[model samples]
Target: MFIVMVAPECAPVAKAGGLGDVVFGLSHELEIRGHAVEIVLPKYAGMRYEDVWDLQPSHHDLWVPWYDGTVHCTVWFGYVHGRKCFFIEPHSQDNFFGRERMYGYDDDALRYAFFCKAALEYLAASGKRPEVVHCHDWHTGLLPVLLYEQYAQVLGDQRVCYTIHNFCHQGLTSPEVLWATRLGRVDHFLAQDRLGDDTHHGAVNPMKGGVVYANFVTTVSDTHAAEARYGDSACGLGHTLHRYQDKFGGVLNGVDYDVWNPETDPYIPAPYSASTIERKYLNKEALRERFMLRKSWSPLVAYVGRVDEQKGMHLVHHALFRTLAAGGQFVLMGQEQKHNGINGHFQHLKDHLNNNPDSHLELSYQEELAHLVLAGADLLVVPSLFEPCGLIPLMAMRYGTVPVVRATGGMRDTVFDRDHGEHADDRRNGYVFQHTDNQAIDSALQRAFGLWTDYPEDFRSLMLNGMRADHSWHRPADHYLDIYEHIRHK
Candidate 1:
């Protein structure tokens, strides 16, 4: 299968969110399954040449909106994880992706609009008309629109599949965007709702436009797919998804085994497996030492990811107060993003725990240190308000650490409840909370704490079970191939 993945982020090159993890992980898994999979992402200023392999050149045209000047970007290619990926070298001002953050730039809409144009231009220039061009998130949402309006005329049957990692990011642009592309046949009809038609709240919605144009629409998770059609989760864009429900579906993201392997992890103090469960304790001790804490603790619960409110940071923060009060220790290894628009309640938790000694909150972010914490921690926390498909819990489980997560989206599909246990300590994978309240999180924590405090034997067995579980992308990638095949045929 000659399939191509078009996303804005990729691992070891340009990454900030789970989207990078999805691209690199899924591409590798698909390639391993004997599928010719390639990824297309922007070559941000942060790219490292040494991280990429088999470098090659492919020309592309990037049109600058404000000026009539043409920015001819040199499209570079390198193989990562046995999958070829394309990077557009801006060559122009390079100010488009000069900043660190992936989103929220002053002219991100313009930058991404240029990128979408470059992607289409590159596809035609490179002469690689793939069977399927799977576009992820709004970053590459315009690909479907371009394919249908322009490219489809030339390349008759190149099926396009646009996967929405988050529908919240609707790439809205105006008629100026069309002019910026040098597209002569600009239709005023496209400015409407169905075909980039209606201007959204005065502007336009590019993500929604892709939804209406793309042959198929896939969210990150099934639960979120249904919820997105009509709920607060949609961020006021659920109606578009509901209208296109026949074409919309969900495809869960997968964790890359190579990136999160316990056997050869350079970050952990000592690598151990399910058979050698005793070695995991050394990692726990080392993690405590790294954080400058006492080695002897009841049960060390850890949270290691973005400190955003959507990740249920407040619930974890609230849980910490009770966790310490109940004679347990809590460790956090991620920084919070300041200045929230509508969802910024986690700041309250941070403010409340400023002078508090019991709550050990470290305001930092380190990948190496995170790997150590995952290997060492007795329990991992994932209290997301609504996760499309989280990878932290899956990473935690890989290192023999039990995951206590909120029951929603991928969590529901991945993490089994306590009742599924074959033994008293049989449900050792960790705890689960369904509701998005403080009580629900606390209830799950209590369950995890009780098992660690009283049932030492059961806890060890559970950790072993978690370590033994295979959350790798191999199986999930095969599932993705199935989806791809279906998408291609449809």
Candidate 2:
């Protein structure tokens, strides 16, 4: 099978969050399974070239359609982590994708719009057609629309699959921006209910466009798919998803063991496995030292993610204080959202930690520190209001760190509650809370702390079980392959 993945982010080279890990991990897994895989991403400024293999220029030139006119762009080629990569660069004063960061620009809609057209232009110009084109998130949502509209002739019978990593980002833009796609007038799509944004009337939503046109759609987890269709976490696309329920499904995102495994992870100071679980404490001491904490044997609880309200940062803050009162240590590694006042909250955590003996707070995203914390911490916290298949809990599990997560989305699917023991005795991985309230969080923490304090053997058992669980890409990749074959046959 020939597969092409189009995403705005890829791990190790260009990454913001789990989306990057998913793209790079899935592509690499597919290629390892004997399928030819290629990934298309915009060549953003300051992207580390050292991460790309045999990085060089390509003769491929693209004429990307804009609202007013078409702009020329140069296409560069490279191999990232064994998968073929295409980096498109637009030469215009607009400076699309020329920023230091991958996202958070006012003109993101325009930048990604240009990227979508340029990607197809490159594929058409290069005369390469894969059996399946897998588009990830809203950043590449327009690819499916472009394929069916403008490039159908050149890319014949190429099935498109769109995966919604985060439904919160619908890529909504003004209807006039449709002119840039060269997909004909937007009125027909709007009138026919093909590319409409039900939440915002008369707007052009690229995600909705992809949903309406793509052969199939997938979210990060089966539970997340259900939520998007029937639950409150749909991000205002429930009607569209429900209408296309048969064509929409969820597949759990897999953890890249090569990068996250405690036994071989290069980032962590000490390599330890389930059998050598005591070695994990050395990493704990190292992490504490790195954060300038007084060495102690207290249970360490850590949180690793964005400090947004949706992630239940407020609840996490509450949990942190309670944990400290209970004599348990806490460490947080996250960045604040702009204008969200999370910076002040994080500062408060830091101030509390300054007086506390074994507490630490880092107001940034440090991948190396993340690994060390996962390896070191006795428990990882994720109290999300509504998570759509989170990866942090799974990563923590791989490190033998029991996850304490709110029962939502991927966290609900992945983390089996040790208290309930619903699954096999050996498979109960972590603690799960039903509500995001302070009381619910306290109950979970009490259970976790009890296991760590009085039942050391049981705590070790839970951690070892989580470490031995299968969270790798092998099964998920096979699921994706099945989806591709179904699409191709249909």
Candidate 3:
């Protein structure tokens, strides 16, 4: 079957967070399942055009009536995990994506609306009618809206499935989007939930419209699905998600072992497998010596991901101050990417942490460094207030680095607290805290440290257990195949 994937971000091209990881991981697995998959994303200025310059040129310019403007669509073709990937680059005059950030835009609705319409038109023109048009996140929410409003009659046979990687980034359809994209018929979108909750108290909400319109909807994890069904973790779209609970579900994300495997990985210093467990320790000692970490007494605490508030930076920062004071070796491998503002967020963070850079603290966003840190660390910390299937902790677990994460969404589902007194065997993956506070992080860190220092034998056992666990996409890809077969008729 031919699958069309539309996302706002992808890896090795343009990325800000886990959204890119999901796009690359899932697309790779889908392709492995004998399905021809293609991806569509905006040609942001930050995209690595040099890497994908070989994709054949296959796009054109189209104008929307009354908008007094033209939108340029450039098509690029490639393969990810043996699956054909087609990427779309949308050119905007006002530097829509020219900046070095992924989010924070007032005109996002207008941009992606034109993007969805253009992709459908391109599909029709190129004679490439996919069996499923899989739209991801609120960024591509307009696909279902446009399909029902415009493309359904012409491409009525194709089914549309929308995956909500993050429901918060809605492409709100305001008067600008309604008029600029040439979507057609404002009354049709407005009268009685035609466009779902794109308008809430005069404000537009595009994420809600996706839940209402898609043939099938999926979150990143089963726990996230449950949280979204309730009013807790929906990020203001809980009621909307609850309304569509029947068709909504979650697929616990899987890691790409090809990129994360310790044995074959080129990033880590000492390559080791499940059998050569002792070599990973050498990597840890090498990591300590390379980073100039002097606190060999305490268990090394590590962090990797976006250094933003949502990642519990407020708490992680506080815990860092406290944990380091308590004689713990702390290493953070991350970088901050501010969307669009007069001032840069990275500069602000550097000004705060620049006082000392030679200690256990290292701030670099390079992908290879992230893999090295994961392989070398004793405990990986992910204090995300809300995580959409975090990949770092999973990678950490694969490398025998225990994770200490906040028990929320995917974090709650993946990391298990072995010290919780029951299911000790199954719960030996990592440490977890429920409350999104520094207090919780402090306690979890203490418990993880306790296991690392006090119970060296048990800690080694836990590491061995983590290495043996199967977190790969092998099973999840089968589940996705089941989903595809179930929705094949649509």
Number of the predicted model whose TM-score against the real structure is largest: 2
Give one digit per residue, the lDDT tens place, for model 1 in 231-299. 666666677777778888877777787888778888887988777778888987887777666656678
Residue 202 alpha-carbon offset, candidate 1, angstroms = 3.3
User: What TM-score does prediction 3 earn?
Assistant: 0.90
lDDT of 2 by residue, 264-333 (tens): 9888888998889899999998888887777766899999998887899888898888888888888989
- TM-score for each model: 0.89, 0.97, 0.90
Candidate ranking (lDDT, best to worst)? 2, 1, 3
lDDT per residue as tens, model 3, 1-490: 8888888877767677777777787788777766777887776777666546455655554333226666666676754434455666666566666766656676667666666777777777677788888888877787787777777777867777788877556665565566666654666665435463523644445666677778888888888888778756777777666667777899888888887899999888899987898898778777777676653666677888766667887776766676667667767776764552312443465466554432354545877678878888888888887886777888899999998888888877777787873656955788888887778888988877777878998898888778888888887777776777777764
Where is model 3 poorest over a 10-residue stretch in terms of lDDT? 337-346
Give the local distance difference test score of model 3.
0.73
Ranking by TM-score: 2, 3, 1
Instruction: List where candidate 1 sits over 4 angstroms from the true fold.
Output: 48-50, 53-67, 173-175, 182-199, 341-360, 419-428
- How many pairs collide in each candidate, listed in order? 6, 0, 1
Between candidates 1 and 2, the one scoring higher on TM-score is 2
Off by over 4 Å in 2: none
lDDT against the true structure, each candidate? 0.74, 0.87, 0.73
Please report the candidate that would top lDDT against the real structure. Answer: 2
